[model samples]
Structure formats: C-alpha cells, structure tokens
Target: MTIHVIDTGFFKLDGGAMFGVVPKSIWNKQNPADENNLCTWAMRCLLIEDGDRLILIDTGMGDKQDAKFFSYYDPHGDATLQSSIANAGFQPADITDVILTHLHFDHVGGAVHFSSDGSQLLPTFPNATYWSNEAHWDWAVNPNPREKASFLKENIYPIKESRQLKFISGDSPFANIDFIMVDGHTEQMMLPVIHYQDKKIIYAADLLPSSFHIPIPWVMSYDMRPLQSMTEKTNVLQNAVNEGHILFFEHDPIYQAALVEQTEKGIRIKERAALIEFL
Candidate 1:
C-alpha cells in the first residue's frame, strides 16, 4: 500500500474562528495571522493506493465558486485537485472511492466541478463512488443557518445525481481499512483508520485538523458542539498514543503527519514528519 499527500492549495480563515476559545495571544504564535486576522491553511487531501483501489480522501475547495464568494476567504496556491491526482500517477477516473470526512465546502468542494461554459455541475471523479455517512448527508442537505453557508449545494447533490454516491457504515469493509464516526464537528463525520504497510494511520479530518489543535481546549469555534469535540479529541488522542499510530493531518500546512505522546501539558504532538517515513 502507498499513501500520497494531495495538496489542492492553501486558503485563509479567520484565526479566531479556527481556534475557538483559544486566545489570539496563543494561536497567533502558531499560525500568525494577516492584517485582517486571517491565517493561511492548506486544503490538503490524501490519496491511498491499496492494490487496484485508489481512494481519495477529502477533496479541497474546488475552483467553482464566484469571485465574490472567494474574496471572503483568500484561496491561493499552485497545487490543484487534478494536478495532485496526477502527481500520484493517476487521474480522477482512477479513484475508486472518495471518503469524505465531512461535507463542509473546503473539505468536499473539489468533489464536483462546473461543466463547460459553467452551465451544469458535474462530479469531478465520475467513476469513483463518493462516500459520506447517511446522518451527515441529511444534515448537510438541510443545514441550519450557522452552517448553511459552508454546506453549498453546488459541491454536493451532483454525486447523487451522477449515481456515484456510497455510504460507508462505521466498520471495516476489508482488513486494510476501518472507519470511525465523530459528531462534534458535524453529525457523523467519518475518519478513516487504514492499516497500511504494517502501520495504522488515522486521517484526522476536522477532529484534529492540525498538530496545533492537538490540545484539548484548542477546539475550533466552527464545531457545532465544542464539548463533544473535546470528548472526541481525548478519545482519539489516547488511542493514537497507546498504539503509536501515525496521524495524517488534513489542514496543517507545515506538518504532514505526526506521532502523539502524553506530555506534561496533556496530549501533545511528539514529532512531526512526513507520512512516507512511516511507510
């Protein structure tokens, strides 16, 4: 099995919103903000190759939104979804499965794209089965006001329309992969724990977006239930530390992956390294 880091690009978000209750005095040290208090974040994705099945996890924000919409959050970078896929020596048609951590715009936007002349929406990976939980799928389609803006219909619906959507139960389909469900970030956000090359790697999707967010209290304000996020983080971190599991970060720009350890200041990142080191 081989794993490749697919960097779609980097974008900016309000540092305060990304760090929740954490004071700017602290998070600012980690991700220094711009003049407007927005910190640059990577729309990093992962592509896993196990035999013939090429699985893509969490497509980054696609380039389909209007300029006005993109002005709010600065999306800038050279890497794109297609380029990243090709970097792995494959194309969108090669992806057999797309495991979405959640349906937020940034995470799932690249799953679909606009057709020629921007008239119709189409699935980016026309041959792949796009994965999402039943619960989260319902929640995103009928979103509340707080999250409605993040859940855009253009990024979704097209998969179902294209007849390529698959819902994964919170269980392993094969010996190589397993799924974990967490609700704090969004209802039933699915995180994939893959048994790769004699090592287990957890795709810490919004649950632990970056190594900086490893601390229990550094939860994101965007989460619907902050307390639930704490519970999820504690449990996942504990298990990761116990087994020495490699954590694949989705949004962290600098650190690709890391190992966790219980420290003087609760659970903290032990070492940051590339995912290839483990493989």
Candidate 2:
C-alpha cells in the first residue's frame, strides 16, 4: 500500500475566524496574516492506494465559484486537484473511492466540476463512489444559518444526483481504513484512520486542522460547538500521543503532518515534516 499527498492549492481565510478566540498577537506568529488579515492555507487532500482501490480522502475547493465568491477567499496556487492526481500517476477516472470528510466547500468542492460544455455540474471523479455519513449529509444539505455559506449546493448535490453517494456505517469496505466520527466541528464529521504498516495516520480534517491547532484551546470560529471541539480535540490528541499516531493536516499551509508528545504544557507537536518523512 502507498499514499500520496494531493495538494489542490492554497487560499486565504480570515485569520481571526480560523483561530477563533486565539489572539492575533499569538496566532500571527504561528501563521502570520496579510495586511487584510487573511492567512493562506492549503487545501491538502490525501490519495491512498491499496489493492484495487484508489481512495481520495478530501477534494479541495474547486474552481467553479464565480468571481464575487472567489474574491472573498483568494484561491491561488499552481497545483490543482486534477494536476495533483495526475502527478501521482493517476487520473480522475482512476479514483475508486472519495471519502468526503464533510460537505464544507473547501473540502468537498473539488469532488464535482462543470461539464466540458459548461452545461451541467457533475462529479469530478466520474467512476468513483463518494462517501459521506448520513448525519453530516443531512446537516450540510439543510444547513443552519451559521454554516450555510460554507456548505454550497453546487459542491454537494451533484454527487447524490449521480447516484454514486454512499453513507458510511460500522466497518468500511476498504481494508486497513477506519472512520472516527466527531461532532464538535459539524454533525458527524468523519476522520479516516489509515493503518499503514506499523503506524496509524489520522486524516486530521477540521478536527485538528493544523499542528498549530493541536493545542486544546485553538478551536476554529467556524465550528458550531467550540467547547465541544475542545473536548473532542483533547481526546483525539491523547490517543494520538499514546498510540504514536501521525496527524495528516488538511489546512496547514506549511506542514503536511506532525507527531505529538505529551508535554507539561499539554500535548504539543513533537515534529512537523512532510508526510513522506513519516512513511
């Protein structure tokens, strides 16, 4: 089995929103914001190859939104979802499974795209089964006002329309993969745990978006339940330290993955490096 880092690209987000209550005086040092206070973040996805399954963890924000929408979050970078997949020696048709962490635009946007003639929206991976939990699927589609903007219909509805969407429950069909459900970020956000050889790699999704967010209190403002986010993060971090799990960060602009250690200051990043280094 092998895994590849699929970097769709980078985009800007309000640093304050991303860091929640964490003061800019502190988070600025961690990520450093621009004049407009927007910080750059990567829409990093994961591609796993095991047996006949070519699994993609999350699809970054696609380029389907209009200029007005794009102006809000300046999405810029050379690496695109298609380019990155091709870089890993595969094409959209080669992906057999797409595990959507959640339906947030930045994470699921690339899962669908405009048809060649721009006549209709369609699934980006024409032959793949898109995985999303029933709970989260419902939460996104009938989104509360707070998260409605992030859960764009164009980024979601097409998969179900294509009849390729499946809800995950109990054990996954894929070998060496397990799902961890956390509700603090959104209802039933699924984090994929990949058991590779001797190590367990957790796709950190929005649960622990970046190494900087490893601290219990650095919850994002976007989360529906901030206090619950802290509690879930503590439990996940404890398990990560105890079991020597490597966290594959999804939104961290610089670091791809990290290992945590139980420090006197609570769990903290032991080292941050490229995902390949962990393998």
Candidate 3:
C-alpha cells in the first residue's frame, strides 16, 4: 500500500481556543500567534492507495464559504484538495472512500461542493463512499450551539443526500486501517490507525493535532469535554509509546510526523521527520 500526504492548505484560528488552558506565554513558544492573535495551522489530509482502493482521510475546509466567513479564519495557501490529489497522479473521481475524522468544516468541508453554475450542493468525490459514524452523523446534523458554527450544512448533508455516504456501525471503515474513537474533541471523532509497511502509523486527526499537543494537559478549549480529552490523550499517548506508533499530525504547520518516547516529563517526541520517511 502507498500513502500520500494531501496538502489542502492552511488557515488561522485563535491560539487561545486551540491551546485551551495552556498559557499563551507557553503555547506561543511552541506555535507563535500573529499580531491578530491567530495561529496558522495546516489542514492536512492523508490518502491510502491499496490494490483497487483509494481512501482519503479528512477533506480540508473547501472554498465554498463566503468571503466574510473566510475573513475570520484567514485561509491562505496555494495547495488545494483537488490539486494535491492531481499532484499524486489522481483525481477526485479516483477516491473510493473518504474517512472523515469528524464533521468539522476544516475536516469535511471539501467532501461536498457547489455544483456547476453554483445552483446546488454536491458530493466532491463522485465515486467515493463518504464515511462517518452514525453517532457523529447525528451529532453533526443536529449540532449543539457551541459546534453549530463549525458544522456547516453545505459542507455536509450532500454526501448523504447524494446517496454516497456510509456509516461505520460496528464495522471496519476501510482496509489496512483501524478506527480509534475519541470523544474529547468532538463526539466519536475517528482516528485512523493505519498498518503500513509493518509500521503502526496513526492519522492523528484532532486527537493529537500537533506534536505540541502531545502533552496531556494541552487540550483545546473548543473541546466539549476537556477532562475527557486529557484522559483520552493520555491513554493514546501511552499506547502510542508502548506500540511505537508514528503519529501523522493534521494541523502542524511544519513537522509532518513524529515518534513518541515515555520521558520523565511524560510522553514526548523521540524523533520527528517528513511523512515520506515514515511511509
């Protein structure tokens, strides 16, 4: 199987919300904010190419939102979902499965798009079965007030409406990958734990967005259950260390992947490198 890193681009978000209770003085040292107090983050996605199957994990926020909506996030980058896939020698129609970690705009926005002439919303990957769990699908469509802004209807709905959506109901999401469900960031966010080249490679969605967030206490404020997030992170870190799993960071601007070590200071990165090295 071959794995590809799809660069969907970058966007800015409030550093305070991203770092939760962590002091700006500390988090700033790890990911410094701009003058407007926003930090740049990568909306990175992963592609799994196995015999006759092309699986994409997480579609970055698409370009369908209005300018006013985009002004808040300040998305700026040359890479795009389709262009990145093309760079990998494929097209949107080539994807056979799309595993959305969660329904947040940044993760699943590109799953659906505005149809020709912008008359209607449609599934972005015409030939793929978009995957989300039953619980997350319900949670997203009937979103709570806090998360409503992140779960836009245009970014979702269309996949199911287009008759191309599937739910992971006590079943495997895809081959060569195992799902790890965590509720800290959002309800039932599925992290894809991939077995590639005899290595346990984890696509650390929002569970461990960046290497800086590996510390158990660095939970994000956007998380509905911060304490649960901490506990979940601690457990994942422990297991990752024990199993020597390499983590593929989604929102880290620079480093692509890292291996963890059980240090006296708790779980920390042992080695960091480009995703190509891990693959």
- Compared with the true structure, all predictions reach lDDT values of 0.90, 0.95, 0.91
lDDT of model 3 at position 128: 95
* Ranking of all predicted structures according to lDDT, beginning with the best and ending with the worst: 2, 3, 1
Summarize candidate 1's per-residue lDDT along 251-279 as a digit string, tens digits.
Answer: 88788899999988899889898888767
Point out the worst 10-residue segment of candidate 1 by lDDT: 166-175
Model 2, residue 178: what's the lDDT?
A: 94
TM-score of every model versus the real structure: 0.97, 0.99, 0.98
Error of 3 at 6 (Å): 0.2
What lDDT tens digits, residue by residue, belong to model 3 across residues 1-279?
988999999999999999998999999999999999999999999988988999999999999999999999999899999999999999999999999999999999999888889999999989999889999889999999999999998888788889998889776856688889999889999999998877888888998899889989998889989999999988888988998888999999999999999988889999888988865
Quick one: best lDDT, which candidate? Answer: 2
Q: Which whole-number lDDT from 0 to 100 does residue 59 have in model 3?
A: 95
lDDT of 2 by residue, 1-279 (tens): 999999999999999999999999999999999999999999999999999999999999999999999999999999999999999999999999999999999999999999999999999999999999899999999999988999999998999999999999887877899988999999999989999999999998999988899989999999999999999999889999999999999999999999999989999999999999998
The TM-score, computed over Cα atoms with residue i paired to residue i, of candidate 2 is: 0.99
Q: In order, how many clashes per candidate?
A: 0, 0, 0
Compared with the true structure, the alpha-carbon lDDT of candidate 3 equals 0.91
